[model samples]
Target: MSASAQGYVAAELARGGYQNVHDLLSQACATHPQRTAFSCGDDHLTYAELGSRADAFARYLRYHAGLQPGDRLALQLPNCLQYPIAVFGALKAGLVIVNTNPQYTAAEARHQFHDSGAKAILVLDRLLPLVRAVQADTELQQIILTSVDDLQQPIYESQEDGTLRFMQALRLGEQRSPVQREAGLDRLALLQYTGGTTGVSKGAMLTHRNLLANVLQTIELFDQPGLLEPEKDVRIAPLPLYHIMAFATNCLSSVGMGLHTVFIRDGRNLDETIGAMQRHPFSLLSGINTLFVGLMNHPEFRRIDFSHLKWATSGGAPLNSEVGRRWQALTGAPIREGFGLTEASPVVATGTQLSPYREGYIGQALIETELRTVDDEGNDVPPETPGELWLRGPQVMQGYWQRPDETAKVLTPDGWLKTGDIALLDADGFVKIVDRKKDMILVSGFNVFPNEIEDVLMQHPSVRECVAVGVPDARKGEAVKVFVSLKDDTVDERALLEHCRQYLTGYKMPSFLELRDELPKTAVGKLLRRQLRDEASAAAS
Candidate 1:
């Protein structure tokens, strides 16, 4: 099956249609001109309208902003109509996109902008102050700003520090001649920054072929079971698009399939998220465990109609078995968990509708993708044995931007990219991610995985959210520390410890546990275990 899927992907690409990301957009627009491409709140854009606006932005960047092909353009906006316009326009203008998180701090923003050497930035007005704080530190020559309602309503232009409003830029670009640049498959298309969980964030350089191939690979998998129908499926995109997973899935794959995507700017806002669901009656949905747990806890979640829902996906982090079971029970649709890192264009393995759901398994690798589990010595591990996961495929990135030394650490010269994840491969070829390689806890010379501890804790009804990390212990070398937020205040720490004692071994049990109002997480709802570990180490010191 893997070999045939690889052949099919190669044949599909060899047939020659959409050579670049912009070409993908063009094809979608031509095929579904009247269909809705994207929506946020009450504002939406048809395929044709999206294409026209993207073209205008492309022309504006080339003619007005004076950006050349291969130049970097940073997009720092939430999920809104302007995001697609900026993304497609930047691609159309032959510019590489640097997707910046709107919630980034000044230091984080400065690092990404300076590192990417972005020539221009399209930012949301609310975040202009943060941009202003970091713009002088970057090489940015142009600043294009937009408000949430800029596309839906007219607003007077604010010429603050020679910045151009998003709508104004579009209007001005429409008057200029169209831009026609040849962006080949090998040309770099994106600088997707990884979460600096290990250290400073590094940008993973993705090319046109890398993204386009992943899109084709994903479409092939979805098409096998008729899970997605072009111009028919309504996908709810509540995750931040700046993240690689969402970018590849929602921005690239969904567009290629001509699926209507409803963007929820803030998934944390339960009211707004539930409202969007009420409005769209979506057929497809994607989210993380935190989001699923939050929605299930909300009263409105039960009221929203899930009749049209055909498929659901979970990624960005491991899906707790309890959470998955609850989600399936509530929606009548099982959540198929997938796994990937930014270096692999954010998708390597995902479960298809044809595959039976398995707890903790991320199913098989995508078409044209290869997977390996290896020991620390780089030798292949036995099947079903936990080791570092290695992948090789079209979706693997070219390398880290301007960081060959850093790139060499993860990517082998033989073309396999070390995923830095501890995983196991079963006889059926299913991949089960155990935990991050760096996050493993060593207690008295025994290796303890935090995902195992957290998964067990999540089965307790009183545990709302939790993360387990290894903290310093003079006696044990390192001890398990579990941090949790509760759903029921009646359940005390003793009860939680007793619950853990029932499921965990003596060495695996938490030596220290702390209750928090909430845990730290990335913008995409991934737990910040590294941060918690750092804090715990500091406290121990």
Candidate 2:
């Protein structure tokens, strides 16, 4: 039997109409052309202003850059004014936008750029070194590098066609590749990376239709029809745009509803994001579990006025029940936790403003999405039983890009994308994640795969046998814990962890280490991850 709550009935969500996300933007532009569309610091972009900028960007890409349709452009940026302009412009130009996290090092950047086969890249000045490091190995034919002050030039002078040859040597000084562009909703629009069972990241092929479908559904779920007066709601967008939830709730939903979004340039600048909320008193706040949890801890969070907040949505990791309780107690607005992946246009299920916020459950599926749990053999599991959650909907991605064999393994023949997430649906129809097929850790909104870490760990001669597991952490949500069986008695656990920091990201390194004689294993010699996890919990308690 699954460990799900009982008597939860779900209502269908509407993902209807509009071929792709482009129409949503176009519709909002037509409906609220003059309303403010986005804000960064003192700068405000009206719907007409944003749409026109996107239009100029589209024309600029086509005529100046000469990027053809379906040509992928690696977008390496953090949340700012350029992000939306570049994203929507790429969509308008009919090019696939492959989003990369700005924090990624050159190695990570190179891998993604190589895998995506991007012809061009748009990088922020601060991150130019990373792009410069990987440029030689990548397939990129051209680069469109911009600075922080790129959009500050009156929006008239700065947003124009300015050409500069980036490199002097290697015969690339005087020449720039012309642009090729695409137009339509059916075309591939975005390729967002999600971790695979194998621990390597795979690009999920999200069509314009897929993104637009999820965006429409999200609007239906969160839009306060009567409460949110047209163009009156201000939404706080602090999360990274590369994540689907942030993209949908912040960028896409804001466009469709014509809500003005305050772009949070840096998480390090949480004060700015929080102050914007207090000064403007945002009507809607959407982010991951970590963002909200961190905000709640901020001394400013206690001083803010909750009366203006109409909706709060959290996804990425499960909302810690304690965090949810504290939020409700503090702000009065319930946290509407949702479920999504890079594969399902990022939103499979969501709790609406109308639904009572539950402690752990990620509310009902959006309209048109059919979620079911099945055993290993693909047989349907009875209701309330934890099983592998599979999603079938218009929002589901086509497949993994250029990974047919791997895609076939996860994407079922009848269109069910095996989420690999262990989930349970109650009799009333609410879904809650319980486990994952891979030894993957959800550190805030990012996926930290153990295999990636284990490979790094094996490189150290001191690491005899190490198995990593997700240990519960209240702040970041989950901390990585590795149980080690040493080959040499002289190896110190602390030294091994420090060694891991060299190759693995901070979130992926083992925060807790346990020296063991020999790890518990199955008869087939597979390390029993469950046993290690149980040990971690027992020791913590």
Candidate 3:
């Protein structure tokens, strides 16, 4: 088969009349009004109810908050019943969504809020303090908060200096007409922030067309044999909705197909997540490698009935073959490994349960998405040769928001997004990711740059210099290990780690800290991260 024919699978599916996600939501609501669209514990919302609430929120944004179309609205909440309400509401109101991670500290929150220029934010009531800390420096004009129990327990707390309860906003919007605005497919829908080649965070400008295309691509794959059933499939939402992959798959695609999504507010709590699985005979589940391993390792996982589980999709990080085989042995369902990045609206390719599972290879490019492994000279490498992976598709983000120079570095003029990962494409189009070009560490599926860690460590007065490298781990696919050269004679690993804990998230935190005499450096005084990585690998071996 020719290289052009690699994406032939996409051509088999048709692009329907839906212009944007709003249209998709409208269609789902119209088709399955009574079906459960989203649920978290006892709190549930039907498609009709979800749509109505979204419309109400839209109305509030337009009339009460005085937000116009194309404005940015930040959503900083965990996986709960209110997540979809805020997301769909922002879309219906023609506002660009900035999906902010609730795990972000005040400083991290400040960067995203300031970068996106978000006018309004839908945050959790408990996380109001984090938002308040950065609100003064941002363009935020309105603050709407929601609690996990707000659906069961009415939260009418509002009128407190630019702050309002999520329920209150919904009630206010319910009084007014729903916001009506038509946006082109090219209009920006989301400002999904990502740490690109450089450690600095940049927003990927995802247009409505990009997200819609990726959703269609995923839906087409799910429609194949033994994958996803429409109304009958109940999926477990363990991954955070703030992440692009979860946002696309769990929130949009699953909801569009009328699949019941059972939300687990904290995926880290394997006990509750397993309990949730036992309660519902869920047919479909999606998560990263760490999540799969965590569940399989849990004692309660053996007690849960896997009779109804049809397919388990893995992404976020490299899927371990041993974990996959063990998962199948326990659950009787092989884990299908998929590949994606935040830049591509997250879903580029996925392995299918219908076929024999490959250990390391991510399945062929999704229908209509083209993939190629290119050399340093920007020429395509031969089949099975490792090279930088490049992708082109309707799902690719427009570019990095407010960073044209940074955008040009990765994206080619012809539309191909140069993924900084080294991969090999077989003649059959299966992509095997061999290595990453950038020194980014994948800690349990989250991207952690070495530079980010070094920067944080540099802030400490006792630290002279530091280099962070990913070390092999038994549990997490990779763990952060920082080697430090101290300025003072005394060495305090705890103090250095404590300083890092203040700036970095849990996943990004270094699990191992080693005080070293010196780290490898280039002739030009540049830190040789790869050398440190090689040393770690050698030591492990």
Candidate 4:
């Protein structure tokens, strides 16, 4: 888009009167009061109902829990009707939300709660045991438990163990007057934790304005003609809301655009997910490459209707060309792959419907966002040369919470946030990610990206999923290692190695190969390459 056109779109998006997430919710509720805002299975809520419940939860937090503005509250729940309610409620009460993963173990839960100094937490009933194990070590003063069927089941009173039921809190809030608060743009809205796969996890401090700007940016992208119908789109929400990508896409952006979202608590269940897709004439679908591959492999998935699909996006991982082409053949909608990280409100660039199938490219930067490919010294690199991507935009996080030393390593003195991925920016502003800076393998002083090796291995008919990592080698200093999960165990390892040798150079060829039943991945289906590297290192030691 041209500069003038970009500015005009930005002006139009700014008219939404968004000072924070609460403002977005308020605007949506007012504009589309009776529309179905969110639904899961048979449970659904209108815009008005969602607004009232969110306001009630906010009031209960103020008058009942006594949590002050800027205080932290960890929300540990899966994708249910109550997830968005808790998110909006926490933001409306002016509390900084910590989006906790419901799958966390006791130690993981304890570390986040204690580090964030959260006094309150909202957890699901199924995860109560894990919370109870870590409660004494953290600063939690109040625990609120919810159920998957909380909205469907009969209402109950608070328990005697000083725990409050999720339904009871809403009822209590209804009895009290609503607390009025409008958070400023600079106020912190969420402390989203990341970096767990690489090493220690830290919270990325995102402000209300950071999130609001990103939502507006995304809306501008989708506002293009033939991409998405504004306020009338139906989306299938298969990704977990705890991840940044899903939080911004489904919980905030889709909701802000007035799209009705269908939540899927268990995205792994192909039968259930396909059934949900069939139940609704969803216009927009969003997920990672693994999900698309799973759906394509399922016997019943191809029978579902996809006539209404206007947009299909893949994020949270690289989209394989083979997988993307097969998906397009089946669904008749090309898989537009985008790139993002947790620090930049999760979305930095995306592919539009106009140019959906640029091989290995992540389209252009968002309007009002500036991107630079820089060398190690912060100088701009030549066009099409891979370098670390530096981003300066309103959507970038403030810094890592309470870790200034660590934050200084990534964020520059001015405003640029250093993304750890190696990428190349073309003249037209299209970005093609090479790989993570840390994930690059150095063999005989040559840098090799794992994506290239994995892409080659993915072409093999027997390989279902594969990840490449660098392992120690006394002769070459470092060598490439590949771990793969096959379609079945009948395929010979020698044939796979021969295929790799035919496609890759001597240095890029895998020096070691291991077969596995499955590879480690994040909840969002991002391949955990760091985990494989760690495993290899431990085994070598």
Candidate 5:
């Protein structure tokens, strides 16, 4: 508590041992040697096994692929066990891992691959088509396709579509590449892409220290109740691993704390997740609002046991009040909603999982994180007033890759990373996000950036001018709402909708449509979305 004690601790921290995620994992693997570190359906991996596989993959990447240090490898997959395997493997091989969401389109995928200068790609078979379309144009040289049952022996065929219809589908991956280097803790572990909710997606250059700091920060956040103790804590891994929340909370947290990370294979099966929850008596379950809502909606939700649930953190999107209340009522537990972006190592603030419910608020800063609410000019805003949330802490990312101009705009000279969402902090320091600076929609937990939507809408010949806005939705928090004005008055709503569907994901497509004689624009002729939102709200009222 005293200044002398603080200085002493800081001096000790500077002594440096394991400087990265790989170093952190190495210690964990050694400490918990035979403990189960990761599990999916019937497949379980012990800490020693996980570390061994990663090292083997690392050797494979170097000896066979000839990928030297500082190179990037693009990985696009869902929440399968291989997600961690590949991520750890890449880190072991001294390569930067570029994470991609399987749901991304060819255009979205290309932006990340080209921007990051990735040389190799690891993909799931079902997503192969999406990557194949863009590989010819990108810098990637090798493609390694993984099956859903790669971890478990005698892999079953779940489906030809790559869903792993049965656990027996996995065959030995014929070794194609060899990995040759040891990953130093100081090197980059992940080149995570920004959601681009505001504009073009930029890769946040996160080093081993950046990610490792956040992992320790998270451990402190939950250390209050000792909820993270291994052998006692079991975590649900249903959230997409590509997202930082799952990568950090579900996978990295498990390794850092020596807990079991259970993968929710085939999220379509509600019984599987629920069954795992009961069988394992999971102590902690971290996820987004949509997942909790979906879980409660399932017919078997009532039957699953929540007797052992100790930590339930909600992030990646706002946790709806209705879902929160219902979950508390059913399970007698609070869904602690937190807030973070792809930057900041994806954790700026979080609510207390063991405390009472604080509806509509993303809780206090984790230990050692200092936050500020500032206006466009960077001056501090009064408490309870909305403004962009800026943070200067151990968890904030280093910078954007290769885009000095872009990074300069977001990172303040004093080290604060400007989060584009408008937020308000109560006198108690709890943050509540009121609005977003970017024209982005939060459909469930997915980001639907308006610029991307407008780009798709503009393809229609009849679309003269258009604007994409987020409309409130009861179930999804917000849905893509589009406003359009036709050039020749020859297009119908159906045709325009069809054009958008062909290019974007189902969640990104507009849920509400409006036709206008001419869109509301500023005096200079730039379309004004706030004005359109005002009109839409007025009509709704």
Candidate 6:
């Protein structure tokens, strides 16, 4: 690591008030006791109530469930009141949190549970069948099932199948006092699973210091003049909290700043999500490209008042420039895009309120973070040159959990993380993420980035969603193939190809175009290029 980077990180941590993630909640409770901290559907929790309930859940883990410090606890629930309670509670009990996506299949669930060696899990009641299917193959000792309305409904103890209800556990937990456990800043706080798109998902081991530093870094960047206000801004959180972006931003950073976060249980359900926005008059919104497109297309979206919306953020995937422009036209707030991976506590750079809107740029690096673009030989590239992006900062993860071989591949011995993204840094220090190094398509010996193609395609009025992938070609080594889902049946393949030819060069233009009802995306709304590539290769074979 660079000496300057280390000095900056040390200084920031020294002045940062809290030591652990849960400590942020404690301070928020003390400072903003009566303010609403989190809400879902019709249920909400004041800062004080959230803290007390978290303490109760912590007591239940320690005294009732016999969970001890350093134990792993998997939280497998959607956006609900129990999600935040379980997260804060698990952290308070000195347990490492494994944020499991509730959409995981039985095999995926089994692999993560067995790999993390999770001793307990707080799962949604509807997902119990999948958990039960995989329970015998893993190290899970305790099962706590919860419904969407667990906090509002009456408690029911169902120990018949060796499972405990969420409300019942909280009720039993209230009988005991809070557990007093000392958590060092260096101790592991969360095992966030990532990299599933490439292969098997690996858990990124984030320490208390890593998460806290990111929270402070984000707060420093966004806390400009006339920007974010504490205890006043209402944030609409439609993304799943299990993802590292939402976990670091909404669950930790937003709470630390005393923001009232309204959770949308199912972001895919546009009606419910739009309804939440209409009801809350949220000042901040965070989402990816697909969510933004879906919201803007919804008939009810324009009905909601956007005057209260101060700023919006986009991540998880590249924000199409067309989408950003349309969003700004519809709502007065500009969609400031950010860049990060799960390893850097998920946020390395973001656009601030004062920053100018630049197409394909992800703003500047966060406070105390160092960013560089390195060539294939690991030498620094000049400004405006594209190379693999490298980051070194306090927010970087300790390492991947129990995967030293995998850890050695990404993290350097000198503490710099080799982000697999190809990016360009201009003379002004603004970053434009070219593409993921692995995702770069080599067509006729020239690098064709999917983002460049997708960006051009998205500008077409009829193109609702589009993705580009490299397919096997007999003449050239590989060829560009485009998949698109349109707004209507007005345009055919010839028209789309003609549209692409107008903007894209001959080499960058699509050799083949396929139209579909919709393209496949991840739960977080990232386009699945690998899946499409695999299908294309299979068809050719």
Give the range where candidate 5 is weakest over 10 consecutive residues by summed lDDT: 165-174
Say which candidate scores most in TM-score.
Answer: 3
- Kindly list the per-residue Cα lDDT of model 4 for residues 89-202, writing each as its tens digit: 889889999988786656668888999999999898778788888889999998998888789894567554878998888999999997775558889999998652234578
Q: What is the TM-score of each candidate against the true structure?
A: 0.82, 0.89, 0.96, 0.81, 0.90, 0.82
Kindly list the per-residue Cα lDDT of model 3 for residues 319-430, writing each as its tens digit. 8888888989988987888899999998887877665456788888887788999999999989999999999988899899999999999999999999999999988888
What would you estimate as the lDDT of candidate 6?
0.84
Residue 23 in model 5: shift from native, Å? 2.1
Write down the RMSD of candidate 2 (Cα, Å): 5.5
lDDT of 6 at 161: 91
**CA lDDT, every prediction?**
0.84, 0.76, 0.86, 0.83, 0.75, 0.84
List, residue by residue over 378-477, the lDDT tens digit for candidate 1.
Answer: 9998999999999999889999999898899988999999888889998777999876677767554344678778878999998999999887664455
Comparison by lDDT, 1 against 2, better one: 1
Which portions of model 6 show Cα errors greater than 4 Å? 1-9, 196-198, 440-541
Query: Who is ahead in TM-score, 5 or 6?
Result: 5
Give candidate 3's error at residue 382 in angstroms: 0.8
Write one digit per residue (lDDT tens) for candidate 6, span 1-541.
Answer: 1123445555766765566689889889889899999999999999899998898999999999999888999999888888888888888889999998886656668888999999999998888898888989999999998888888885577754989998888888999976875468999999998653344568999999998888877877765666888767999988888878888887888888899999999877889889999999799998877688889989998799999888899887677788889999999889999888899998998886788767889898887888989999899999999999999888999998998988998899999999888899987778998766777565533346777688878999999999888886643446788899999999999999988776564667898899999999999998888899888767755
lDDT at residue 392 of model 1 (Cα atoms): 91
Higher-scoring candidate on TM-score, 1 or 2: 2
Write down the TM-score for model 3: 0.96
**lDDT per residue (tens digit) for residues 1-541 in model 5:** 0011123213323543645567656877878888888888888888887776776667656766677878998888767777776677778678899988887878888888889999988887777777778877789886776767766543444433322221221122124344434645557778998756555788998877678777777766566555456867788877778877777778776788888888887554667777877678777787777678778888888887888887588888888888888888999877888887778887878877554456788778766677889988889999999889888776678788988988888887889888888999777778889988877778867777888889889988888889988876666677778999998867788889988988886778898888989888889988899988767656644
Model 4 misplacement above 4 A: 1-14, 196-198, 440-541
Q: How close is candidate 2 to the true structure, as a TM-score?
A: 0.89
